[model samples]
Target: MCGIVGLLVKEPELRESLGALVVPMLLGMSDRGPDSAGLAVFTELLENCNSTGVVPSITRKYSLYIGQHQIDWTEFTHNLQQIGNAIIKENGNHAIVVSDCEPNLLKQWIKQHYPQLHILSTGQTIDLYKDAGNPAEIIDRYQFGLLTGTHLVGHTRMATESAVTPAHAHPFTAGEDFCLVHNGALSNPYSIRRQLEPQGIQFETDNDTEAACRFLEWRMREGDDLETALQTGFEALDGFYTFLIGTKDKLALVRDAFACKPAIVAETDDYVAISSEFRSLAHLPNIKHARIYEPAPEEIHVWMV
Candidate 1:
């Protein structure tokens, strides 16, 4: 089993505390998943930077990987300068690399040259972080509490079906402003991957959750809205799952007809939150009086902020 937590803030004043608020929720679900954890934070790119901080461009955002080897930052930025003015932010084992280059060309350059360094997610608003560690440790190391963002979706993986590594972690993102965290295993991901590959879809890890993330992305690319794409998933994805999808302005929760997985949703005038269990939501602001309920199977709940 894995744990998934998502927060969509309705009140802008709460954005600065997004990470601080979500950490307790993630740590509370440690029993469900202790292998690896990740979070996707969506916010406007920062225009200013201090000496020891990240410099984000207003036009672009990138999620970059450093791997086990270190690269010369001065040399790397110099090379990147040829394509566009690049800004770099280092966080634990990864970096958020932003440039003014068009996203499509930037992606091409990354795939063709820096094949070893993975791009976790690329968008003007989304920054993704994943690592092999407990949720509390990962959060502390990343200093997520200092982050200000519109929303965040986090996951702690149990790793029942894949290797315990950063790549296999949840909250997998394959498209701009899109990411997903799942709580169950798929029955036919290999077959499903085969079908998606021919459509120009790419996958980094063999994790079933990655397949689900890409599938939803592909469907949305084919002109389906979030609700419609998930409806297609209900008929197409073969598994028992509870999926929490985060996009630039939307957060959605859906479960299989079998409803074999657990999910809880809490909503109030100030925010909308979801997690695998009720305890995860206990620490949220004014949560005690929120409208809390378990979503019925096959029922898709979409909240826009």
Candidate 2:
């Protein structure tokens, strides 16, 4: 069993409270998933402005995690001087390095030099934090209470099919600016992986959910829009799953045709909240005024920011 939570704030004024609102929804699922927790938050995009209101070198962020490894971050930043316009903001063991330089080059540099540094995500608006531990503790360790974002996808995992480690945590990301949290298992993950591995898709884990995440991202990379990619996912991915996906500007939810896994959605004029169960969403602001419903099997529900 696992818990999947997603929140998308439609009102700009309410975006600052994104993390504060999602933490409760996540805590409510602690019993369902006590092994690990993760969250991917999408904040405002970074961009440089000229008199024309646009600049060609839009910013990109790389969320980095140093797990039980000691590295001089000062030297790291000093080294980053070569990659012009790179800036870093740190919070404990996690740091987000923002830059307008080539993200691919930065990622390769970190991997080649600081192999222990795990690149959690890379995109203009996404910042990812996930690890192996109690959900509540993970939340506090990362100061989830203070995160500001347009939307977020969160998860608590009770590892069934893989080792309990940060690398296997949910909110699994493949390509830039996208993440997926799964509440159910995928039966054909190996088959999917077999198809993607040869396509140059390198997987970071053996977790079944990674296969689904990569497959969907790959479809989009191959020119499929979100809706079309999801439709293709319906055909290629097999098993019972309630998926909560977060992109740069959208939060999407879907269930398997059987709809064996549980999911609930509560939408109000100000925001849309989703969880594995209603209990996970009971504490949201104006929750009683929200229009609540259970998503139908095979239905893809997407809400744009």
Candidate 3:
């Protein structure tokens, strides 16, 4: 009922083509998911903000969603100066804010002021954009074709369970440099939320995918590696799911024991591509020569940037 796409480029030169290559892959999945779509791209760290208008010596970034709301980004940046150096690069209904302030400090400020602005992801390398709309229109609005990154995770949702709001979209995130998109449902999201809420972990949306995303992220924050966190996920998460995960340097995928959802992986010397179905992956370069396979139930696959 959903479409998930991930691309990790191994050859350095292919990095610049990341967006151009992934756009077609995303467009091909328009039928599988027509409600909402999202994309998160991970790039190399850039210490200096170039062409962002307001330059700052930034150490981290927050990909924010304003939806259809309009804001004076210049004045907002001026106001944020009290906390620390802050700058923004606005892109149709979304913006990437680079800041020197702590995550909590900047988050609290935004929540207090522009409550409508939603934090999509927080990190130095990850820039995310997502919203509820026609998949193709959403892609065009966010300018997905211009993205440049080492890897990315994307999703298109059909919204069988929850409301079709931007907040309910997939590619849920927790902590820094981490995000997850799911292709199936979880039966015990409430139980999982109860387990993590006591440990001070927060939930942004009631989406079942968010529960799984935060749970794995919490495990990693507690000292488990990506693979270890996913093993823990296999035990903790209950439901049918094909999860495509993205981190600062890793792209991982896993399925529940049932493998109720569909997932296919295409790998080549230049990049690794994954999607819910092959039609979405047909446009990749030399795709006919790539080694392709369907993941086994509960199998874990991880690709490094």
Going through the candidates in the order shown, the clash numbers are 0, 0, 0
Roughly what TM-score does model 2 have, to 2 decimal places? 0.96
- For 174-228, candidate 2 gives per-residue lDDT tens digits of 8899999999899999999999999999999999999999999999999998989
- Report how far off residue 213 is in candidate 3 (Å): 0.4
TM-score of each: 0.94, 0.96, 0.96
Candidate 1 stretches greater than 4 Å from native: 46-58
Candidate 1: how large is its RMSD? 3.1
User: How many Å off is the CA of 154 in candidate 1?
Assistant: 0.3
Which has the better lDDT: candidate 1, or candidate 2?
A: 2
Ranking by lDDT: 3, 2, 1
**Pairs with steric clashes in candidate 1:** none
For model 3, the superposed segments whose C-alpha errors exceed 4 Å read 49-58
Q: Which ten residues in a row have the lowest lDDT in candidate 1?
A: 47-56
For residues 1-305, what per-residue lDDT tens digits would candidate 3 score against the true structure? 99999999999999999999999888988799999999999988645534555435446899999877889988898898788767699998999988887678999999999999999999978999999999899999888998998999999999876789999987899999999999999999999999999998888888999999999999999999999999989999999899999999999999889889999999999999999999999999999999999999989999998
* Cα lDDT listed for each candidate: 0.86, 0.90, 0.91
Q: Is candidate 1 or candidate 2 better by TM-score?
A: 2
